[model samples]
Target: MKKVLSIGLVRGVLGQILGTAAGIGLMTAIRTAMGLGWKAEPAAVLGAFFGVFGFLIAVGVVTDWWKWAKGEETSEAEDFQETPGTRRYFGVSLDHKVIGIQYIVTSLILMAFGGSFALAFRTELASSGMQFLTFQLFNTLVGMHGMVLIISILLGIAGMANYLVPLLVGARDMAFPRLNAFGFWIAVPGSLVLLSAILVGGFDTGWTGYPPLSLRAPLGMQMFFVGVFFNGWSSILGALNLIATILRKRAKGMGMFRMPIFVWGVLATSIIAMTATQLIGLSFQLVLFERLLGMPFFDANNGGNPILFQHLFWFYSHPAVYVFVLPGLGIISELLPVFVRKPLFGYKWVAMSSLGIALTGFLVWGHHMFTAGIEDYLRVPFMYSTLLVAVPTGVKFFSWIATLWQGRIRFPVPMLFVLGGIVVFLLGGLTGPPNGTVSTDLHLHDTYFVVGHFHDTMFGGYIFPLFAAIYYWYPKVTGRKLNETLGKLHFYLMTPAFLAMTLGQMRIGMLGMRRRIADYDPAQGFGPTQMVITIAGFLVTLSVLFLFINLIRSARRGEAAVGNIWESRSPEWAILPSPAPAHNYERDFQVVGDPYDYGLADSQFVELLPQPSSDD
Candidate 1:
């Protein structure tokens, strides 16, 4: 019992419970003193707020800072040695690798919850007459599914950046390890609060939570707002940490351009995450305040412009897509050269393209408002800006194709996912212009077609690349390879299932199926298509199950992979052993050549400095 209580996660959760109770009691006391009755919504919001801080304090993520407040000194020595094994993962630690794993594991757990919500709603949509689910429940599931998966994607991005960025740059750890740990730990309680919405009365506004609708949503709305508010802190802080690490922590001779291509993607992503995440947080907070304090920020009935909400939300949310994709695209770029055994074609162009996408992403948010009654003049410019994103995106595609041209290519599990990501992302890209253009978007707005396109982008840009990264880096993290047979099974089953589902959705949507509806009329002749999508959804779920099994079984029984498994030039794989060390790089190494000069004879990317003689 003591051992379990000693775990930070357990203690944090218990702390959240106590804090929530205290908040409710305090709110009740205040209400009684004011001669008012208890209200669930305001009390719940306060409790959720208190719960987040409680989790942080109990987890000990803020312990060092707390000690610093009193002028106490905290040891900066590496502590992973003391905790030793799995226990370190459950507790607070300053190691970036452990924090990265924590973020990823939490992301997968959230994915399971989000995916489960999706499967439930997809099942309900199979035959279309709200078979088992209530109308409110269906609406709640759809919204929760979108928001939850989005949060999961953000965490997944953080996970990859945290784990790979330092190793790629030959840094000992993140520039601010404590800040990194704090960023990750805060998201735990935030996610709990987000999920707690379902336990309360679930909100009906979709994930966008547009105003007028959001103003009238139930208590759960505040939970969603508060949850996302806290999670945004993680994104903003993590981005700041990544930027500092990349700027200051590279080994000798590793100049800006010479760093691995993945670092460029992270840098571009960090730029967006740091500057733009505040808008969404502000937008959500506005709605929360409107609900709690009757602020007229988005209350249309009170002379506040509801359209203002769209601007604030999409300003962050649209660029937020690049925030999710750039790193995954980087993963694709990073791994492509290893599998193809060639230099990345147009390396500088590909790197700059990431920045280009980030810059262009900010200008394109107005495209989402084409049919939302925005002014006429803003439409064409936003349209052009939206299409401009295709240019940088096209650069990546060109680089990938050229790199694959006449190269020795291998089809590892990771390579399979990379290829799958390319195809799916291409589908997403091709479908995007229609939505970006005003005339076409007027026809397709709020339809299953848009849903299909969005899913394609997410699956292609983030999900597939994330899986590829995990498969490629698993040996480095665990000193064991995932089962190839099962991985192939996961890829084959999921890819086709996803394609079928997406295509079926687009087809039905073109045939007049709207999104977020609990039912469709039988006369619309959409039952067969919807059923196919639902079945495909289940198949995708099964494939993920296969991956989970592979991850677990292979961790213990898989083949030993202690050496360079991929034969790449990256420091993490070529120079370091499997399951990278806590401090990374026993000796300082300097960048000596191009990062992806795979086919060049006698080329080296980095050179390790020799150790000094003890006699000296």
Candidate 2:
């Protein structure tokens, strides 16, 4: 009992409960003393706010910073040595690798919840006539499904960046170790608050949470707002740490252009995450204030324009898609050469294309607002800018194809996911132009077509590549490879099932089916397609189950991986051993050649310096 209680996660949850009670009691007392009636909404909001800080404090993520505030000198070395074994993961530790695993584990947990929510709703949508769920419940599921998966994706990105960036750049740890741990820990309480919305009265405004609707929503809406607001800090701070690390901590001879391709992807992603995340948080906060304080920022009848809300929300929301996918795309670029046995064709172009996609992502947010009655003059420029994103995106495709041309390609499970990501993302890309075009968007807006396209992009852009990264690097993390037979089964089942689901959604959407509805007209003959989609959704879920099973069973019993399992030239695989050490690269090394020079026999990516003898 004592051992279990000592776990930081256990203590943090206890802290949150106590803090919430205190906040609610304090708010009630203050309201009663002031001759005002107690309000559940305000009290819940305050409780949630205090609960987050309490979790942080009890988890001990803030201890080092608190000590600094007292002008006390703390030993960084002692902090690392204090925690050992798996307990380090439960408690706070400054190791980037541990934090990265923590992030990934948390992401998987959230994904499970989000995916389960989706499956429940998909089942309800199968035949149509008000099956098993209330209308409000269905709407809540739809909205939560989107938002929770989105947070999961963001956490997954941070996980990959935290674990891989420092190693890729030859740094021992992040530029700000405490900041990295803090950034990750905060997301835990934020996710809890977000999930707690369902226990309270759930909101139905969809994940966008556009105003007027949100202002009138139940107290759950405020929970959504508070949750997202806190998660935004994680993105912002993690981005700052990543950018600083990339800029300041590269191995000697590693120039901006010579760094690993994945680092460039992270660098571009961090830029957007650092700057644009504030807009979404600000938009959500404004709505929260309007609900509590009766501010008229988005109240249309009270001299406030609701369209202003759309502008601020999408400014961050749309670019956030790139933030979700760029790291995955970089994973694609980084791994493709290794499997194909060729140099990354047009490496510099691929690296710059990541930046191009991020920069262009900013100008295209207006496209989402085209149907929202923005000024007529704004639509044309937004449409053009949205279409312009394809140029950089196309460059990546061209490079991928050219690199695969006449190369010795292997069909490992990781490579299969890479290929799957390309095809799915291409379908997403092909479907995007019509939505961006003003004439077609008038018909497509708010339809299941948009839903289909979005699923394609997200699955292609993040999910597939994420699986690939795990499959490829699982050995590096655990010194054991995942079961190949199970991985192949996962890919084979998920890819075709997902394709069916998205394609079915598009078909129904083209036939005038709308999004976010609990039921459809049976007279419209949409039942069969909906059934197929639901089945496909279940199949995808089953495939993921296979992956989880593989991960657990193989962690202890799988074949041991010794050295250079993929035979790649990258520093992490080539110079470092399997299951990277606490501090990476015990000896210093310098970059000596191109990162993706795969086919060349004499090319080398890095050279390790000789160690001095004891006599010296």
Candidate 3:
């Protein structure tokens, strides 16, 4: 881990410093000695390359001459030992459980950061102008928040599924554990690059990074490109790892059909992430070249069409929706069985719907650009594909409602979040059919209607379930109980506020209010909905404050929890400790019956943990 960091950090820093001197010296010597004028940019880039080479030489010398001699890698290893207060989590820990926990922690931190940006944007809106920040700053905040949350949402699913799915399917670790670590580490630096946009300048393209507009922005746009590029790499790696794991690592009895619906959703999501992420990465890299090296990919003056960037970008990004939402659907599938006290209805159908969503997701990217004036003939196929998505989505919705009806229901935080997601996602889906229609989208193309619909699907999909999943699995992760009263308080405050904020957005959109516009005349009808959304935004912000407090108060000082607090049906929950040890499952436990047999079999129980050794 230290080697990786040293290689990246020292090499970059030295390359910049020495490269600057080398270029300046060369340029001065050329003009002075030869009396010949030439361009400076090429020399500067070459110099930076030379400086980077020098750093590599230093690295080789240090490693071969000293660090590698007398077993320094082993002896000097203690130097890299984590200090008590240092960021210990940045190291490589290939344990699926550790990586899973890391993903959750990372996304949570980024979520807070993203939510803070949302608050700032809301504050600016509340003042109806420059009260908290300037116009550029507001735009930057909104854009960064959107990007951060999008990245966070994508990774958070992989993380939760990583921790839960293997155990749910009775597997030991991922199919490729080392690659899993690499997948997660990629996101760490990617997030840093994204956040750096705020310091350098700011990207106003939002996460969408629409071209022509993106090309016209400041150098900060380059930072956005770098960050997003790295994030795409992470997604690709995770998707590949997950697909491989699901295919090869299932328990003895669990086959593709027998696997839990949650795992199936992850499998579908992995496929989408694997195949779709590359287009976005390549598209963004093309934009980066155009910005940094004056490439002609999107340059209209150079005969390159900027619209091509949009086509390639949304080709991957539109499916990126399923990348985010499908995992939440998986979570809901997992939760329904536990809380509603019933086997998931139409398990086969629900599982297939996940794959259905993924396969069809690729065909719908054109829907995003209905207003961009693509070929007239192209619109109909894209519109049809876009509407085709609704069928699979609707199937999952019906399955959930069917599961909940006439069952022994428990209204816990997890169930609440799942139910909330179902309701809100339905509302979001209602707007989608409109967007699919060429005529309707022409009017609502860039309006707040788009904003409202996404928040409904995204927040309900990611944020709401995130809290629910956290609470559901808290005991297993931390070996402690979260304060129930505080958890309920957190839930009540958050859900209503989110509805207020997102629902209010729907009204603004219907009233023909445009998105990304700073302000308008106070006399217009936009004022009421604008004020309502702003006020609701603050309410949601306050709700987050309560959640943070609950997490902080619970993780450390909360009472130690017992294993299987819910008497969970799965084998992973049958451990002796609250949070299971490094390798879960005792030797005494062997496959006997299905996990959801409930109280049907007296012989279903197995001897707990610390399985017999070879000697025994």
Candidate 4:
């Protein structure tokens, strides 16, 4: 373990160095291409620097990723082989736990940065733009905000979870931990490339990276394309690792049905990631190469339909939503049983429901393009599929309610967040069917209504649940409990802010407001709606202060957490207080009951039927 750590540190450092150099090379090429009189623009120069630096750091970690991947051999099965200490972890380690932390930390950084950009927008929109930022800068901020948030979700949930899932489920490590790390590290270059666009040329196509407009933009579009493609690759590889691990790795008695809801959620997500995430990778890469190399894959003037790219883009990108949101659903599912004080009701149903959503999620990408000018018949099939997703989603909702029905519910901060998640997710889910139909989507398409609906679900599904997971499990990762009072305050302020902010958008959408325009037409008179959203946005910003305060304070002086804080049922809670050890359980743990059989006798817990031994 010590040896692996040293090697990991070395590799990590090296990857960062290489990545930085590569990014600078790309920047140099772009500058030359634009014929900028031997001097690069300041923003482009800065973007290239950070993008290259960030990519190098991400790629560095990929070097040690092999120890994490699966085959006949595993790091653990090798049983304490001497690993050389180097700077590899500074580059990459195959350790799922380390990679997971990398993803999580990266996501948080993006969140803070993105949120700041959003706050900038809110302030600007509050009284109309006061010339605080140029039109180009404002557009760049909006586009970058979208790109960063998407990266946060993909990296934080998918990258981090890929590393952690094997440990959480009580396997030695992920079935393909090395590949898992590789996927995650690949995202670095992509992020840097996208960032380069902002620093170097500033594309306003938004994170969706729409073509034509993107094609017409400066070198920024190409950079956005490159970054998105790399990020997509990371997701695909991470998904494949999770699927293989869940399918093959398990302690003696854990069965498919016996797998934790978190695993089920990830399992479903993996399928989506493996199958659907790839198309976007291909499309984005092709788009970048085409734009740079004059291939013109989506240029209609060259006999290519731009909308065809939209279809291909949506083919992966839509399911990518499930990839993003489903893991969040898994996080909620993992927490509710503990907070609600009951075994998850309809475990099979809830688990299967995640899979159902992932599958159905793919068929509904057309809903995004309703305004992109596709056929009329295409709309209804897309509509039906979009609406059908709600059914599986509904079943999961019912299962949560069932789990909570008449239980000894604890309203701890984590619990409060989980409840909030359900409320918001349901609100978002309910809105889908209406918009799924051709008539309704036509009305709300690209409106703030769609924007509001997604935030409710996405934030509800991801953010609240993320905090819940953080509160519920951060102790396991970092041996400290965030201040309780501050946490509660955080929840209180955030929940209302999320509601007000999201719901306000719906109101504006209903009043016939569109999205992505920097200024609203005076005829629309968006002053009041904009004000409400802006205020709600500030409230949400205020709530973030509590978290920042609490985390910083707790890290400095918070009481060390107990081994079994919250009395969690999962293996994660089984670790000791403060700095979880390598090889968490010294001995193979013998399970005697259902994971959440808190009040019931361990004997009363139904034993899931065992699986055939790996040896068999």
Q: What is the C-alpha lDDT of each candidate?
A: 0.93, 0.93, 0.74, 0.73
Q: Which lDDT tens digits does candidate 4 get at residues 352-459?
A: 899899888878999888878999888888888888888888888888888889989988888888888889988988777767788888889888898898788788
TM-score of each: 0.99, 0.99, 0.86, 0.87
Candidate 2 yields a Cα-based lDDT of: 0.93
Candidate 4 residue runs with Cα over 4 Å from true position: 1-91, 575-578, 590-592, 604-616
Q: Order of all candidates by lDDT, from best down to worst?
A: 1, 2, 3, 4
- Shift in Å, residue 298, candidate 4: 1.5
Q: Report lDDT (Cα) of residue 514, candidate 4.
A: 74
Judged by TM-score relative to the true structure, which candidate is superior, 1 or 3?
1
Over the stretch 221-266, how does candidate 2's per-residue lDDT look in tens digits?
Answer: 8999999899999999999999999999999999998998899999
lDDT of 1 by residue, 1-616 (tens): 9988988999999989988888888888889899888898888988998888888889888988998899998878365343668999998888889989999999999999999999999999989576899988888999999999999999999999999999999999999989999999999999999999888888899999998988888888889998999999999999999999999999999999898888999999999999999999999998898888888988767889999999999999999999999999999999999999999999999999999999999999999899899999999999999999999999999999999999999999999999999999999999999999999999998999999999999999999999999899999999999999999999999999999999999998888899999998999999999999999999999999999999999999999997898998999988998889889888999999999999899999999988878997
Residue 154 in candidate 3 has what lDDT? 78
lDDT of 2 at 306: 98
For model 1, give the 10-residue run with minimal summed lDDT: 75-84
Cα RMSD to the true fold for all candidates: 1.0, 1.0, 5.3, 5.2
Predicted structure 1: lDDT: 0.93
lDDT for model 4, please.
Answer: 0.73
